[model samples]
Target: MSKPLRALDEAALVLFSGGQDSATCLAWALARFGRVETLGFDYGQRHAVELDCRETLREGLRKQNPLWKERLGMDHTLALGALGDISETALTRNAEITMEKDGLPNTFVPGRNIIFLTFAAALAARRGIRHIVTGVCETDYSGYPDCRDDTIKAVQVALNLGMDSRYVLHTPLMWIDKAETWKLAEELGGPALVSLINQESHTCYLGDRGTMHPWGHGCGECPACALRRAGWEEYVAEKARA
Candidate 1:
């Protein structure tokens, strides 16, 4: 683990997706960074509901904590929905998700994190910021190659070199699983924030928020939902033991 950063009044940008992971990442960044901004993508995902959730959560957080709006800057939604016109992944397509070539799930959007981070870096540079936070976890990250630690590190190097800037890409959930993510939320704020995340964040591939599970509300069968549920169960059990 890296030493805890205490740079007062420094700014950071978080790639917020309005999911359980990204919401947790938003909280994580706000707790550490002096000023935090959020970036969201409208990359033609099947679950476009997440975008709405992103806004709702942002507003909810600001209302829940009055100083949050000042500490956490405005949220920006990028228009990369055109990526779906070029790709045939399950996340963008309405087809059933299956293993694609290279054993990755069809839901994996090719170069998603790559493109998101690149854009975020450019935005951060323009705003005189150096820290970019994302909520990509590899411990339970299904099979997305882009979510790996090495991939992020390589991208960080390439981004800094290409942009002639020093951008520190922070991945707070890189090594932790979903259960630990919940724990992180608790640590960042408290049970209220955790409850807020549970109610507002979107994580279902099928965009089914009607089904409520122990972890969150989603289509229980999807890979994302399964991982979330399992992680929640682990977290609950751990809490019980403690």
Candidate 2:
């Protein structure tokens, strides 16, 4: 069994994407870590609008709490936009999202989590930060192999061996499904978190924020929307029963 969550009381760098999971992880880091920073990637996703949302949410979270302004340090949006030029995935291009023979979805960007975690580890090492937080959950992921716990552990070992430094990668949502994720958000920030997630965070693949679904706002057709909708329904039903 995986270990339970603990207050690490150390500086952390969160691999934030301005989505529900990342936002929740950021909130979790802020509550548990002594200091925190966020790193966002502009990998030229089809929904680059999420980048704008990241900045907006960062500011909004800061404004919501005085401690956030002081403890939430520099948030960086790195320019990996060149990934779009070289990669032709559904997330960065207009293409049909179908499953491959290998059982991975067309939306899966190969090595995305690996690249993100590598860069996060490097940045954290430079800043003397030991903990790197990410919201990669295998339980609710849409068949993204990179989001698996074993993949994360392999990358962690490779990073430590390559850099000769000890870095702890924190995956608070690894074992939890989406309903548990919603519960976690509420536990960390109460109803305000629910509002922020529903109103601000971007999870849609098509970049359609105008449409509303039971989960949140999205195109309502993508795999992401499907998982989110199911999770929200389950969470709400559980609450109603309680």
What is the per-residue lDDT of model 1 for residues 156-184, given as tens digits with 9 covering 90 to 100?
Answer: 99999999988999999998888899998
Q: Write the per-residue lDDT of candidate 2 for residues 1-242, one digit (tens) a residue.
A: 25445555679999999898999999888877778999999998987777778877888778777776678888887888766777778998999778888887788888888999999988898888989999998988888989999999999999999999899999999999988999988987788877788789889888888987667789988888888888888999999999
The candidate 1 region of ten consecutive residues with least summed lDDT is: 61-70
> Candidate 2 clashing pairs?
none
| Candidate 1 clashes between residue pairs 3 or more apart in a chain or in different chains | none
Predicted structure with the largest TM-score when compared to the true one: 1
Runs in model 1 lying further than 4 Å from the true structure: none
Give the runs in model 2 whose Cα sits over 4 Å from its true position. 1-9
